[model samples]
Target chain A: MRGCADVRALLGDEAVYEAAAAEAFPEYNKAHLVSLELPDRSGDIIITTYGELDKNNYLDPRTAQVATVNHIKQNCTELRPAADEELPSAYIEEFRSALDVELSKYVGEAYPKGVCAVYCTSGKDIEGPGANFGFAAVISAARRSPQNFCNGSWRSIWTLEFSDESQFVEIKGKIQVGAHYFEEGNVQLDTNIDYKYSTILQSAEDCAVSVTNIIRHHESEYLSSLEESYLNLSDATFKDLRRKLPVTRTLFAWHNTLALSLTRDLAKELAIGK
Target chain B: MEAAMDLVRRMPPGSTETALNALLSLLPDHSIDLLSQVDLPLQVCMDKESLKEYILCEYNRDADSYRSPWSNKYEPPLEDGTVPSEDMRNLEIEANEVFSVYRDQYYEGGISSVYIWEDEDKGFIACFLIKKDGQGKRGYMQIGSWDAIHVIQVGPEEEGAAHYCLNSTVMLSLTTDNKQSGTFNLSGSIRRQMSMTLAVADGHLVNMGKMIEEMEGKLRNSLDQVYFGKTKEMVCTLRPPPEVLNMRLPDR
Candidate 1:
């Protein structure tokens, strides 16, 4: 029966505890202030929520759990507010399934086959702020050609992190398209193209659309360009086989070279006879 | 010619082995390995008549009737006929003659064949084939090309005009082997489709001829540009040319 309001109340209590700890441990507070100024530690400060909270020493496991659930619910619309009995990882799964539903709309229409999955890590493994958690959505599709003995696949991964400090979600995306064609004793062709992107979104409403648009742009622009290049490479390879040398060039002096080598053999034979 | 002459001039007056080594330096490492192992004074000969027969046999294998080089099996004749009409057979013979001349002009010496057939009440289908084989002192090569064109009639689009669909496919295969070097083989096919509407009173053969000619030219250009040209560029990117092997002894 613990609703989102209860989670908010828990977060407020944690904030009060954090303020009390800062006053009690002024030395620890001063060290944190000094560490924040160091440039090398700036990146770690953005991703290591656990390190910051551990130094404060005020967040118990229950408060940490409530803070994570509250942060995710506030940032992502893909999942409902977590229930009291539900784990934080369960919310990640719910978010993943919601995104999967949106992505599956492209399957069989834009792609022949597809698979979407989500992966997450919490506590010490968390690399970014807000609830000490991060998750990645992996979306992939493939188009196959049994006739040509060839297949092509495209994959896009979106790693998302919510930051309480910035009040925004950081989305790092990578897309790759690859194809392979092989026929025994004939030809083998393989080609691939890939790109990476980093985006900051104020809300999760447009996340699914953004991912699909990225896929569409990649397929229409980069993937088609890759296919064109592959066709050219295939053609050139065949042409090289057909004519090793330019037609204008006379044949290599194989006959003359053979004659000279034969004369050398004959001379050696005659010398042995002598 | 100038490059080879320059290479020969750079060779010192030593054993044939030294001269061969010098020559081998200009080639890629794989080719050099093959050439070095070859017995000198190699000789190869290919009989034109036998080659022609072999090509014909290969083309007709597994066929019940007159099989075109581009097709695996002979197409059934339109209407109640066991064989193609005399006019169509005669056209095939004429095509063979024309393609032979083309082979002689471009390929030096090779074999050529053509087949034409009526497609029910629609239009016609024609297939043209050319094959060339060569045997050099240390290597051999075989190259063949097949073009098939199908013209189908769609009802007239307007008064006194007929609409037709022309579909064509061009296939190529090449195999080359050097006795001392490695072997290379490649085969591929490409297709094109077109629609045309011409006056019904116009000679069907003339319209078909023009269509075939244009289609062939466009397809060939596409193959050259999209395939061969792109592939060559990519190959260069994949493996940049190696630096020439320096055969000269460095000055101390």
Candidate 2:
């Protein structure tokens, strides 16, 4: 779908988001856009992914599902893409400026290094020639709000090619955490280390998979739980592509905040990137 | 037919005693000795005093001789010269799980008991710590038979972090079950500290870690309730559940 306008109407002048869906497009609304008003950082963020991506897109869902389970909630926001240089420059600048305010959360000296930015195009139709960030920085940047990809945060372009609506699902990178990183919160570790796809999953792949996996985990109840429980996760097999560190303990609390935020009011409230 | 039904109702793990009677009524081919071998926990047979106790308590001695000795025999010498013989018998058991030797023995002078030995490997992967009554009825008690003493070494999967606690003391207890009802306490010490580096090359150890912690021998109330959807149904696994009977250890 193209040019849907539900989120902006919902925000009602509140700078949290701008959304668009198939209601604006001719066909059914199979696509969505979400942009966030990062009130505390440098620039804003826009996340978008197809509504029908499968769960197999992610490398590992079981060991990694707990990465942000409790923090999830029911979030269904309508996101609108930014018009190109054709649109008003001031409003777009305002959105980007809000993100700069959010960036302050992780701007300290010890902030992670090797950040990368990766995004995908379903139709390969991204028309903007913006300064592209590296994958490491891209992922590092998204850390403040990974769920944006699933909610209303969509960027400026929808790569439409031969009837295919294109989009960048995720941006990639690692935070270079230390040896003493124990995720002992209701939910922690915003992302996962073990990925399963054979294709080198760009950050685009990670975002698509993460969003799709969440939708799938919540779609039906315990139908897939057995498959999740007994799969052959023999080792941290993806460790070769990863760095190693001695972790004392990590408790991934589920049935709590992570799932709540991701499942419920994330897209509507506390809309980080969207 | 009357005799066959009586045999069915006599005891738990007692189908062996009814074998001849059940077979007599059926065609020769209808009854087959599917039994291929007799193994033991350590090849030790029931002690003499316990054998007397079995007969006196109306335990069918005819079936006693046919069961696996190590699993059937219950005797640990309390006297000065008996430990070595017991050790020798146990040593042979470790060699192969196909055969067992049972004997009769008295432990606390007045306490007579049946000693049963199964495969030294998987069947009893976790050493069950059993606590018997200073005075009670006799049999190779299964679930509902006796309280269980949990031990660390009882499960088959003790390797990494678990082996360090010298968790050599896995204690279990017998909950509710389908036989003579009274919990017995079973307990034991690992001959060694244990090794987490156990190389489970292939078959029988895919879930080696889990088997070390819990195996197929014992059953729980949950399995039946979960599997059969009944609150207290005993039809779990078509066999008696492994009850956690003896749980005195504070560590468990």
Candidate 3:
């Protein structure tokens, strides 16, 4: 287990100080929060530091101070017993149900017109001795302009499973947001996050929170930004939206040939009169 | 020019053919010589027949239960294996009567028809059609057609609150021909969908009628804007004005 002092030493005093300064004044901290994974691949730690400089002095190295620290453990082996305890079928069923219950709360709160569904499957592989179990929860919402000129849809899916051959549990999640416009183009954003946790409850809670945060971010930030950019692009190229000739100019003349026939009739009439 | 004249002469005499030939005979030699250089034809008699046939085919297809353009509520060949129920038949008659009045109000002189069918257990679908064909002296002819199809799906009513999904399409086509200026054709369609949840207890028919009325008004405005405003802009881009056409000519 690596402590805060060890992480600080590894990152060096100068880097840690800059990170601390970023935490205090995020605007001034252009580098943002830096996350480093430990060598053992057990977890990741995010550190933010702060520093103040004298406004009047041109050359001054301010003292470094710690602002905030976050430690996320990825490998949670304590969830299972130390012995080679086989996960029972009943336990797996309970876990799946609990995951559904946990994710359903966020689904309802996040999307008014959305739908959420849970799927679970368990079976013994033909070549393996142990049974494999998988659980997935999904939520989707979509809306379109009345004329279908533009439309947008968002979906998030979270899955937890363990294969018969692997002793570790796998947790994966993905969020996809997309919008299509008839005149402009398509905008798509996809994010994927995965971790290895032995316990099902913790993974489910983590997935729910992550999914909710992603949805909130897209609703509040990405969607509006995309709309503004698309509007700007359309305005800048409004003249190009004009309709163009559907056919070649030469091929278009074929339709005019019909009028010449009427002219020929007039010529015949004049000749007969002469 | 000779081939086109032969084609027109071989056509069966109809009102359109007679009008076109009369206009041709009246043209003077100088005008005829100039027009002969361009390779364009006015309206041909066959075009009228084909347009009529196309309209009839569309109407017939709509009438068939198996080939309904809108979503069908009941599966084809009902319990008794009959296509339309008596209720649907009555609704169609009522729609036709109402839409014909609407057509007369908007069009100079035209024919109108309306068809209504059950969508599912929830709601219904209605289609309104209007076609107008006219011809004038000097080989001038115009044809205008409009189709408006509406699909209304009702959601479960809760605490006197009703939800409805309305999907509609409005298609308009206008083709005009002139002896001197050739022909211009404008045709396009727009589709829109709207969902409404209302606390009012208005019947579905009343809601549908109101929606259709509003949609028709909007469609007319959109057509006017696109046809008159956009077409004018596009034409100006394609060809310069009369003043600019002769700008480079020097005094002879």
The list of candidate 1 runs beyond 4 A from truth reads A1-274, B1-81, B102-108, B133-164, B175-186, B199-206, B236-252
**TM-score of predicted chain B versus true chain B for each candidate:** 0.47, 0.26, 0.53
Q: Which residue pairs clash within candidate 1?
A: A47-A127, A47-A128, A232-B231, A233-B231, A258-B41, B34-B180
lDDT of 1 at B206: 44
Query: For each model in turn, which proportion of the native inter-chain contacts is also found?
Result: 0.02, 0.00, 0.00
TM-score of chain A of each: 0.44, 0.17, 0.35
lDDT of 2 by residue, A55-112 (tens): 1111011111101010011122222332332221332223222322233222221122
Estimate, for each residue in A1-274, the C-alpha lDDT of model 3 and write its tens digit: 1223333443347676457544533332212222233333433222222111121111000111111222232211211111212222444535445555555565554454554544443441223335566655555555545263444445555565655566445656544443333221111212222223343223434544543454344333433433332333222211111111211312122223224445655776999999
**Candidate 3 — which residues are off by over 4 angstroms?**
A1-274, B1-93, B119-121, B131-141, B156-161, B198-202, B242-252
Error of 2 at B179 (Å): 21
TM-score of chain B of 1: 0.47
Candidate 1, residue A102: lDDT: 60
Interface RMSD for each of the candidates? 23.4, 29.2, 27.0
Residue-by-residue lDDT tens digits, candidate 3, B114-133:
55556665455555555544
Give one digit per residue, the lDDT tens place, for model 2 in B84-180.
2343345323311211110001111121222222335432232222222322222222322222222223223344312211222211212221112
